[model samples]
Target: MATAFYSHPDCLLHEMGPGHPECPERLAAIEDQLIASRIAEAIERESAPLADLADIARVHTRAHIDFIERSAPSEGRAWIDPDTSMNPHTWRAALRAAGAAVAATDAVIDGRYENAFCSVRPPGHHAEPARAMGFCFFNNVAIAARHALEVRGLARVAIVDFDVHHGNGTEAAFAGDERVLMCSFFQHPFYPFSGADNQAPNMVNLPMSARTPGTAVREAIDLVWLPRLEAFKPEMIFISAGFDAHREDDLGNMGLVENDYSWITEQVRRVAERHARGRIVSCLEGGYNLSALGRSVVAHLRALAEI
Candidate 1:
């Protein structure tokens, strides 16, 4: 079976500000590398559909949804937090970003694809049930995981996050839910400053120091995350695939490189093949340096496509 790649042009229309790290060009960079490296021809491409409000409401409150809807600006940017904002096209773009994740989940579950990757963004993971923060508008992975469990009738699912920062919003969404198992590692004392203490039993939160190397990350995954995920025996696996931990990225001080992402994806793939019929859906979370982001995504896709 082929891997599906989900994205939309609408996602490129939303931008926070002039020099913001999370800009539309991030997607363009990935596209450029896909073409330059010939990975574009290897995977199946699909356009992302807009998510229904009901689907979004599974993880976010109706009031929060309404707030985002009403917050769309007519001309300039409307700030949600100091670092997050909405432009005229942001409302539609946010829907497309989340919609990509949900659509990819369905495609993988239905066996249309062995696995999938969503390249859309206003990058989610920080957006909570009642608030949007840290360059996120909706918790896309959380919403899709809920959909798999509640709407699609899956008994178990797992979420893996490897962003430089903690996935506070995703943690909030599935903290106490036994049906979902979340494994994540992020820089300690970092932005959002979460996932360090008081994590639920189902969540394996590993906080590393600023200069932690990829070897330590891989060891942690093998020692900690793999055991929990193996025990969970998830029917599907979801990844909050953030590449900002790369050494070239200025957002964080982690020393991860392209090979690190490929290795991580391979480990996740092995688990998927063992228990979940190779079902995995990965959505883009963060990667600021355009060159590094593009290269890292290519490495991730090569592993996902097994090429």
Candidate 2:
């Protein structure tokens, strides 16, 4: 089977604000690029299902889900925090975002597809288990990893996050749990700065400074991620793929180009091939700046699709 593309129209309905960086247009930009680049025709696409409470409960608490559902504003908007807010559609969109992950995980693990990529958003990596912040609500990728381990019966899985910011929520959910191994590289001293003190034994955290180049990232992957991944021998691989670290993106001070995304994706592909039967389920986490997001995601998906 081809690489599965999982997304939903409701994901676009989760509007933060009119002038917010995480606007609804973000999804449209990605879809436009994939269609224009012919990437859309080359894969299978599925509209994301609304995630059940049980599926989300795999990562988020029942109380949290209840709070988010009830937190929707009747007229205007409700602020979850200074950074995160809920419009009426935010709750449904977050459910579909997490649902896409669950579906992608099933596709990769069940031989339904060679691999999968979740294109839904409110960018889930920064969402903690008990807290919602940084434009995320449900820790979608973390839920996927847990589902693979708990429901799909995978013994070990590795999550490789190369977002501009750390996946603190994912780490919070899976920390101290040896079933999942995580290796991530993100700009330090950035938003939600926390990876430097990662508490998990299987967690390999690489914290770089702002504007760090591709060379520096390659060094960290070579010196850090690969060794730990080889030793762990993960049965499955997941990517918290974020393109905001691209040189053209203004969100972070990083200077990576589209080729940088492809380079990292290629390296991760090798690991999946060698250790996990080329099975990878990637979920989108962050990337603003329409042009950069489009190009970088195209480059990333090209690597995933082997085209």
Candidate 3:
């Protein structure tokens, strides 16, 4: 089976403001790369459905869920956080973003696709069960992980987050749960500095200093993430894919280039093959710098699709 590409038109409607780093253009950039690289022709493209409330409730509290449904502004944009805002369309976009993850999870796990990539936005790695921050309204990957376990009945699941910032919300949701394993690396001195103090043994947190390169990130993969992932033997693998660490992106200083992301995906795929029957669902998290972000994502998708 070919890799599946999950996206929705509503995704572009969830804009924060003018000049925000995590803007609507990030999705356009990736789409441009897929077209330019001719990668778009190779995968199955599908529109994402609005996530079921029951499926979303698996990761979020009922109160939090009700709050978001009511938080969407009727007219002008309403601020949820300093960088996060919502208009009338934002609620539907959040559901589609979360839905993209669920659809990808289903495609990979049910053998309908070899792997899946979600290009929806209002990126969700930083959204907690009860809080929304970092431009995220819902914890998409966390929602998918819980659904894969509770709905699809997978015994174990693994999440690999290589975002510029830690998936603090995800770590909080699944921490100490034992059913899920989270391995992540992010800029330590950056925003939302909490991954370093991982309260859960299942959370393999790696913090990098400014200007750290792929070599250091790779070392972390070899030393910390891989061992735990292999030991967990996840029935399904999920990735919070973020390209902001690329050298051209102003978000974080990891000095990573296109090849670094490709290399990491290769290793992630290998682990999935060994442990999870090659089942993987990757959700978009962060990527700025349009050109670099585009190329980096193409490299990542190429590796995932084995193209």
Highest lDDT against the true fold, candidate: 1
lDDT of 1: 0.95
Which of the two candidates, 1 or 3, achieves a greater TM-score against the reference?
Answer: 1
What's model 2's lDDT at 122?
Answer: 77
Q: Comparing candidate 2 with candidate 3, which one achieves the higher TM-score?
A: 3
Q: What residue pairs are clashing in model 2? A: 247-256
Candidate 2, residues 30-83: lDDT per residue as tens digits?
Answer: 888998998788889888888888888888888888888889887678999997
**Using Cα atoms with residue i matched to residue i, what is each candidate's TM-score against the true structure?**
0.99, 0.97, 0.98
Q: Candidate 3's residue-wise lDDT over 1-307, tens digit each?
A: 7899999989998887788887888899889889999989998998999999988898889999999899898888888889888988899999999999998898888899989999998899999999999988899999999999998999999999999998989998999988999989999889887888635888888889989998888888899888889889988899999888888888888888898999999999999999899999999998889999899888988999999
Q: What is the lDDT of candidate 2?
A: 0.88
Clashes of each: 0, 1, 0
Model 1: colliding residue pairs: none
lDDT of 1 by residue, 1-110 (tens): 99999999999999998999999999999999999999899999999999999889999999999999999999998999999999999999999988998999999999
* Candidate topping TM-score: 1
Model 3: lDDT to the true structure: 0.90
Query: Which pairs of residues collide in model 3?
Result: none
- Runs of candidate 1 exceeding 4 Å displacement: none
